[model samples]
Target: MAYKTEHITQQIRAAREAKNMSQRELSARSGLTQSHISQIERGTMEPGLSSLVDVARALDLEIVLAPKKLMPAIGNILGSASVTSDTLTSEQRKLVGRLERWLAGVRDQFSIASEADTLKDSLALLRHLPLSADELDRLREATLHLNRWQDDPPSRKELSEFAHAVRQLRNATVHRDRDGAVPRSAYALEEEDDDA
Candidate 1:
């Protein structure tokens, strides 16, 4: 299948905007030209695979390709069983494999840990499993450390920071998704008055 350049381009533009980043900022982070990003967003140019990877990296996003299940042909003489199982493309397969490995590692750590706090961290890791496994390994490692700290659980400050970082990462991942994107209505940032 061919790359859906226009769709991906629009998603990138929307994610950038949601993050309150400028084209120049993205260009500087991804080492691409501002004009190039503009053109890509405007649908006048299609970025190469490498450029797309760079942009995703700069935005701390992961690109995942899922198999497009084609509809069975109408009035087919053959039975449905004749159709082979739909397979993910090479890129998609690689990502799935990586995620599975990371999940397995987390499971192993969870099994070894015997503390509620450690289990909670493992649960948190599972909650942030995005489609792309780019950060999965890192999260798995962090959870392993938390598990080892069963005797002395992380401080409240540490847990707060971890939660904030996870939220930021989740925001970056789903910023462009229409249906599953994080809703602003779910969270409220309120200011407190010193006088009160």
Candidate 2:
């Protein structure tokens, strides 16, 4: 939690370089001067929390504080653990983690999840789902339209169709996951072997 400014600077520099962005571009996007950005990257300037936040936002990175033991490392750090011995299988746990991360990436903290948000979120969520090329393209086109219509609300029919398509995608995803899941009999056989 108490990282040296040098470590922070290294992370910032790495993120910028990984994106192949110049310091000037980072400065422009983050609203910091190029000299200041360079100084931060060189570890000559210590950035405040807010400035680091701006840089992080510009680079699409987040700074998370977790306990060293890392219990919060699993699932949502602030939310209830979705994994339980009696409920979620390991596969289900993994899928849930992926979905949560996708949703988190779709929206910043404290943002509302509108219908448009849901469609955008589905694009990332469907990576884990078994979707045909046409289905994927349809979702992508719909999401693009929703994103473009932020200034102008989409038509009633368009919204209805997009929502229905998202529902269909989600239903297909659940069924695909279910079909791919190991049958309970497989677990029962394993239990019997353990007893034997």
Candidate 3:
């Protein structure tokens, strides 16, 4: 594979993993088989434009065409990009902060357990998962539950249960395979004849 192809595939792979999405999940969303995704990520097969667009859309990414002269400006903008759609919303970030504070207060009262660590891990994942209104409400409810315990901290077992509940909530928000008509390809791979 050429360096450019390798670089592009690496970006796709990194983006997929950063979103905590498996290639199988991406395959379902992109309407490509898992093997196809694997090959693309490995740079063994050159990706068609339609295939690349599908994969990028599945990852909530947009592909734009720009003049070559603007490459430096575009690169600079991307390099300094912040809080893209893939990241948690501001409200979600605030809730996570509150949860962290609650956790800190709980730790002061009781010896931290593995469940606390689990809760932390779950919170970390919340940052990466796509935020929807319903998910936000669920997260808010979790924060409310934590706040309730702040005044009267729950027992170790109760805390463990709470951690499990949060983990389940996060898992519920994670994307799953869906059945539907996949998006049509935007381009055809076969070369067109100039004299038709």
Q: Candidates 1 and 3: which is better by lDDT?
A: 3
Expressed as tens digits, the lDDT of each residue in 118-139 for candidate 2 is: 6555544444444444445555
Which predicted model would earn the best TM-score? 3
lDDT of 1 by residue, 1-196 (tens): 2346877787788779978999999999999999998988887777898999888888877676633221111112012212332421344335334434443444433323333344344344334333335444444545464555456655545555554554454443333222334323222223232221
Q: Which pairs in model 1 have colliding backbones? A: none
In candidate 1, which residue ranges exceed 4 Å CA deviation? 1-3, 67-122, 125-196
TM-score of each: 0.39, 0.38, 0.47
All models: lDDT? Answer: 0.53, 0.57, 0.71
Which portions of model 3 show Cα errors greater than 4 Å?
1-83, 108-112, 175-196
TM-score of candidate 3 relative to the true fold: 0.47
Q: Candidate 2 vs candidate 3: which has greater lDDT? A: 3
- Write the candidate numbers in order of decreasing lDDT: 3, 2, 1
